[model samples]
Target: MQPYAQNWTHVTEFVMVGFAGVHEARLLFFTVFLTMYLFTLVENLAIILVVALNHRLHRPMYFFLTHLSCLEIWYTSVTVPKMLAGFIGVDGGKNISYTGCLSQLFIFTFLGATECFLLAAMAYDRYVAICMPLRYGALVSWGTCIRLAAACWLVGLLTPVLPIYLMSQLTFCGPNVIDHFFCDVSPLLALSCSDVTLKETTDFLVSLMVLLVSSTVISVSYGNIVWTLLHIRSAAERRKAFSTCAAHLTVVSLFYGTLFFMYVRTKVASSINFNKVVSVFYSIVTPMLNPLIYSLRNKEVKGALGRAFSLRSWKGQ
Candidate 1:
């Protein structure tokens, strides 16, 4: 790492040089990304509405699913709109104010961390439901669900404060260009003129703790779930139990796989283009697929969607 220059002028804004090599295809990229952003929003909104309006779907699992959908809406919003703006070259599109950049970084970190904990909570809910069928109600009552959800949000809210503060203290002297579409920790750290060893270590530790704790819960919960599923006498019952877990597991894999690759490292040494590509998967693509994954895989969500569409058709008549 280079030492901070003594005669450097402070940068008040950052130019996000997104996909600079592909500027000729801006329209094509804009169209595709915009379509994806809108689809993600609509899909997640549908999940929330479906879970809210259908009484039969009003259970702990759906409750958590609704929260997840809501988080996805905010999570995708943090980056995609700015990215879309950059694509079209509108509203100083690629240029973000220093404060705006930091704010984006904070909110993005908060929501991302919140989702990790929320996923863990959902896994625990499933464990209780499947591994302790008789006590599911008492174990995961409405009050308990609210408290668990609140705790997840609270922890997420706090997780990014220290890191953002540390990042805010770093100096950005000159050449204030970010190589990615969004102001992520790595890209931001890469642009810093100050020594970023502390920030990098903090970021790595924070990400490691969040991933380790959440993944542990998910792993243990699924382990127990698999064990219980094996003891079922009827093959139909086993399949049914496994089906419920499969969607959640798939989602966990998608969310964590990219995250581990993106944030767990101690240094910002990866190819910037590669980082951007990986970011798209978790930041844009995963959220869009989540609602589809749940709705397609879970019968209750599908039935609710069916009822919703039928009600709309009846109203049209």
Candidate 2:
């Protein structure tokens, strides 16, 4: 099977069937989705601001936390605005030029990869702090964090570039109507009229890479965390350690839980919608939840918030 062989040529534009499935519900969907985006933006930005301005919060972990917020802002931008527009009849279906489609694919994959790796990094941070109290500082130093961050961003950007490029080169001469809301990889691949052997192979390999790399990192980090937790002599210390790890664990579970479901069960067609919900979980819901979980559940984040509010109250009074 030829990878780039164009079968049904002349398909240039794609009809994206976002939330317009029910015409009556379109307005409601738009309102709610728009609100979600607004809140996600505000929530994520607040996290960045709170972490940045709070001198007490100026630590390696919080530094990464801010970056994750920034990441969510960009990640959502890749899909939501256009989706909302389609709901309001401003743009029924975007005639995404070939270049635009690939660019979308690249950014989507890049952000997805970055988040996966960042979650792993956070997990490792928790692991080191819990499992190796004495050596945590040395192992996950500020310098090391920066390097890991750079590596994650670089991998996030570069790893998907080739595949997206490869996928774009393949001809899409058939039905261009994408069933899903966004211009994702799998759904896009289904639209291609060309034989997708190479593309599927590449996708499978990439899926394996995403799963193996991120999961392995989290597993190793948590393994160390567990081993260290087992050595705790007092119940209070154990609780303290558990609390510190809880937020990160929640994020890891949320991310990996959805991720594994999507990629792991790629064989079934019904799994696609399931994957969409999972993607929604990570893309839409997780950003809001991250700040809530980290701040509301975390002592340090709560303390930071308290200090922030106190300062504001004093200024107003």
Candidate 3:
């Protein structure tokens, strides 16, 4: 072991000091997070439900969206409930077992990575639909969609394997407090007694590969989309095409904006408080807004939702 690794206490537990200096407003924080969590759950669930039950929504775009909704639910669930606990001082809100911490890290990282690929795939789907309107159906068949979705999940599941292994091998010393709400990579790494230079580099490379590649693909797709839109002579056609992609673009911006701020830049360059705030946006706020963004911007989703509710009402009657 290195000199730094030798100093570790081999601590088996950690205290998550989430939202420090906010004890006075813990109740308010708890109430707010609780409400958001519920809304996120209901909204995401409704998306999945509407997509699954409606035959009209069985196309490639909605198929990916149904899976994306599933990912969002689990992705946000991995952190918010525990953060809520911290707010209300339940289950020793500050304390977390070592195993629990690792589990949280793995799940959060896995789902997050998966969402990156899924988002890129979604952008590609839109690209096909808008740019190659005639070939969209044959190009984005059910088999192809399933394969892409599986690849996203597979790659996401595999990408974190090394990172998680690196995290597990690290030694934790005297200070076991994770300065964030969740067991995120940086906060947990900050507690390690091991020399994390290699670990940090590995994480950066992994994040860059996943995020940069996906961002590039989405950007290119949208770039082409913009170029294609310009050539359309009809004002109504251009508006419809742009509107179709606006919701996805909004989602991509929100996800990547906070993500790049946290990871793409120098690690630990920002204050822990700033990182936490950004984390809340990407991890909590973004997931909640995805369903709303898609539903509000999408005519098909709205129509499906309307039909679903109408059918439910008729059944109840």
Candidate 4:
């Protein structure tokens, strides 16, 4: 192993060259990102607020969704604000300190992994509701849901610690400029001058463990759901059951699909400009859409929204 310069000699700050070649459209970029950021915050907050205030939505599905909304709030925040700042005066986001960068990376990874686990838990809840309606009440009691949610958060918080610690011990004697919107693991790894093989391998194993396990749970749950749906004599009941899982399935595909491409792939071209866009998609777009996808299509959420608004109007009168 080559000796790196001492801490004082290492670069303390990194330049984030976000959305390169868009200098002329800075305002456009800022406005768009700011709008999306506000939307994500508002929509997710509304979900959390609605689920909290409305007794009608206090069931297991919405319980998980409330937590998901809470997670989305932080997940999108970890990256969008910095990305928005990058669009400021020329070379704006070029000053993130090493500590700040790692903090962002850790929080981002934690929330993302938590969402993966939470989604799978929700899938299991759906499977129990559909495939074993007779046992639904006992199978997914409120206490069980709470424990599952707790596990998701606790496990997620632990997932990135080892990898981040390993990465932190590495020397960053190379260029301090990151070519992406945020301090993602891949871009950060690319900037390190030290041997990153161990860190990379650890990251891969951890990612595989999280994604593969969650995906397998979801797949098995859904497979059972399909089998049960087929056995049902009524087509309407089948459709209703399937509809309930549709939004979550869409969210899972959007999230896991992009995640697999970003982290699981064997080789990510160093010069590829598409990575930032993909990062934006998950870190920003997905959070903004989760509420819309889940709430708009969900009849109970819509009913609750209607009631919440009606009550507000009546009080104003």
Q: What's the CA RMSD for each of the models?
A: 1.6, 2.5, 1.8, 2.0
Question: How does residue 128 of candidate 4 score in lDDT?
Answer: 95
Please give the CA lDDT of all the candidate structures.
0.92, 0.78, 0.89, 0.88
TM-scores for all candidates: the values are 0.97, 0.91, 0.95, 0.95
Q: Give me the candidate number with maximum TM-score.
A: 1
Report the lDDT tens digits of candidate 4 across residue range 149-183: 99999999999999899988988875999888888
Off by over 4 Å in 1: 1-6, 311-313
Angstrom error of the Cα, residue 280, model 4: value is: 0.7
Our model 4 lands, by Cα RMSD against the true structure, at: 2.0
- Candidate 4 regions exceeding 4 Å error are 3-8, 90-92, 310-317
Report the poorest 10 consecutive residues by lDDT, candidate 3: 1-10
Clashing pairs in 4: none
- Assess the local accuracy of residue 31 in candidate 2 as a C-alpha lDDT between 0 and 100: 89
TM-score, candidate 4, is 0.95
For model 2, residues 243-304, the per-residue Cα lDDT tens digits are: 88788788778877776766543343565666567767777777667877888778998887
What would the per-residue lDDT of candidate 3 be over residues 194-290, giving only the tens digit for each residue?
7888889998999999999999999999999999999999999999999989889999999998888787643675588988889999999999999
Candidate 2: pairs in clash: 8-173
Model 4 worst lDDT run, 10 consecutive residues: 1-10
Q: Residue 46's C-alpha lDDT in candidate 2?
A: 78
